[model samples]
Target: MPMTSTPTPAMAKQTPKQPPTPTAKATKATPTRKRPKLCPPDVTDRRRRPAGRIAPEALAAERGSALEGLDWLGRPPEATASLLYRLLRLVARFIIFVVFRFRIRTSGQENIPAGGYFLVAAAHRGWMDPFLVMQALPSQPRCWFLGSAPSTFTSRWRERLIHRLGGLLPVWRGGVGIDQHVASARAVIANGAVFAQMPEGTVSGPAGLIGPFRTGWAVIALRVDAPIVPLAIAGTEELYLGRRMVSRVLPVTSARALAGLDHGAEMPPPGTREELDVARRMSDALAAIIGPVVESIHPRTVDPVEHPRRFRRRLTWLFLRPGRLDRDG
Candidate 1:
């Protein structure tokens, strides 16, 4: 039996295989592309090519069209609303602030730049809130207000008046119109124009009560990198008593600067829900900052919460309205 066994091949002769290690070439990653700048159309227009084959008049028209681009506000012709527009603006201001004696208590008035696309926010109390909002500018930076459509404006004349007022961004409520609204806001902001909004939208329901503010302001501020200015209006309700309310230029942005908002943490990435949340927080923060200052100007009513400084009829012989007037005055 021992002689019959044949020798088997040696196990030592077989090679053990090793797993492959990755080489630098085999594991290379793809490079990333940079994002394009999100500048306004006006800025973009500076680089467009001129038309080569049009007649002089036609070329002029074509050239204007090409150069009138704005990242936001659509191409507007060089025309503005009629002179009647200016007169009406003058009359409106005269009636509300001057003849009526609606006093404006402005603080920190030096902060606002004379012009630029910035975001301005303030408390909402009445339909006249817009008037108050405008009258109180540090320097009159024409604002683009996001509002209902021209049809919603109802009155044709009023619609024309609004457009003439400058920067009235129209958005259709509850439908396709919001396109115009967002577009208008985006255009003005991209172009370095001012856009003021009552983040709370609409005249507030009543005094001492405010509705849930919409996130539109946050959206625009975040997307456009525009400065946000929080404002507080106290004597407005009182103005309705004897005259229309007049606005005042408060140093809100400056106040924020004085309050040190400028040096705070970098704002969250703009154009995200996070940006909106920041806007909400900002609204709350500004409200907190101004609440005390406002309280001192107009005390709240215990029986029913008050709205700013409301003046009422004095029972005195000379101050009564209508039939209550003394027959022998």
Candidate 2:
């Protein structure tokens, strides 16, 4: 019973079990194919293209597009009449500085770029504010203004004269022809001229009080890729009364910041709530910058809190009527 049992005959017939066949050495996994890198549209072609080479059709299309859009007063004539322009500017400046006896204090003339497009905006309370802003810039770059159409174009002769000056753009209120005006501004700025607009849209508001700013300036600034300069041209409120006008061209703010806007965003139509909100934000930013300067210039006269509201209400009513708000004489 204690003896081990012998294997069966069938088991004996079977050969001693051999070690299990070793699996063929596992082959390393084949590497996966990598995706090709994507190139930018400009470099999509593998062949190196010559620099500045553009298709004739593309160039022609661009040229044709440029010629279209609302007609600007005219192409900037700075190069053809640089001297004459400067001379005329000087004479006009002299009249403003001497005859008007404006104080003409400026803060950031250096902020004005020597060339290229930019927007100079101010709290407009009178016709002279735009002119003062123009003269205040030490650079004195060729500038176009977005002025009220009815006021500036009162006569054909007046229109011709303003158009000849090379920076006069007329804007209609109550959202009429705004697209054309904005397009015109784009064209002027695209041509490398300075564009200036009174964010307040008119000169009827109280002095030193910033009224509700219009959205057109933001639209132009954003679309034109121009930096907005919040210029403070105070004291013009008393210009006719013999008080000196003090104006300062403040530091430049990116249009995006001033308007709280981004490039290429569809502009809300003029006078709409969305547009007004954008304008109000821009005005707030500008007011923050120029409020102190305005106060220092005309501390006793500034009643921003009460006066601007009343003026705006009156303006809202006038703006709703059939005729233009006649410009200050």
RMSD of each: 24.7, 23.2
Q: Which candidate is the best by TM-score?
A: 2
For model 2 the local lDDT of residue 144 reads 66
**Which pairs of residues collide in candidate 2?**
144-167
Task: List candidate 1 stretches off by more than 4 Å.
Answer: 1-85, 97-101, 138-140, 149-152, 174-182, 206-211, 237-276, 300-329
Q: Rate the local accuracy (lDDT) of all candidates.
A: 0.47, 0.58
TM-score of each: 0.53, 0.60
Model 1 lDDT at residue 74? 41
Model 1 Cα lDDT, one tens digit per residue, 303-326: 233534334423111111223211
Estimate, for each residue in 131-173, the C-alpha lDDT of model 2 and write its tens digit: 6766665434567666665545545686566666666665533
- Model 1: weakest 10-residue lDDT segment is 315-324
